[model samples]
Target: MSVDLQTVKRVARLARIAVSEEDAERMTGELNAILGFVEQLNEVDVSGVEPMTSVTPMEMKKRQDIVTDGNKAADIVANAPATEENFFLVPKVVE
Candidate 1:
């Protein structure tokens, strides 16, 4: 789609930007050029191209999902002033 001075000014107003008539007029051409490039890109055929994460291929780093320092429920609640069933008790603030 093409951009006009009114569209530029409206966008600036919605973004809370104070744009003058000169700036809006300038931005109208700039926005239209950018949209023209995007429209051109839509004409390219990419149906057979696969999605890629990077230009250079490399395996993603991973870590083992083994549990460590677990089964310490009682030890965790030992320092709390109030705890029940390994859960901290707090005063009810809502009614």
Candidate 2:
């Protein structure tokens, strides 16, 4: 697919970019080059190829989902400047 000057201008307008006429022309060429490279990528053979998350093969680790207290209440409250009844104290905003 080719990007024309009008298409480039429309794209610039949608992106809220301040594109001059000369800059739009330059952008048209750059966009066309990127599309051409993507077209070239489409020509590659990928028959029977598995999709990969990375270049190297790796097994995703699994863990059981269970809820438990982190057991650091005292440590967490230690950094608070004002705490009362095992909870952080904040200034009252309403009567």
Q: What is candidate 1's lDDT per residue for 1-95, written digit by digit as tens? A: 89788889999999999999999988899899889888987788999999887888888888888776679999999999999999999999899
Evaluated with lDDT, which candidate comes out highest? 1
1-95, model 2: which lDDT tens digit per residue? 88899999999999999999999999999999999888887778999988777887778887778865687888899899999866899999899
Worst 10 residues of 2 by lDDT: 60-69
- Backbone steric clashes in candidate 1, count: 0
Q: Tell me the deviation in Å of residue 76 in model 2.
A: 26
Q: What C-alpha lDDT, on a 0 to 100 scale, does residue 60 get in candidate 2?
A: 81
Candidate 2 Cα misplacement greater than 4 A, ranges: 44-95
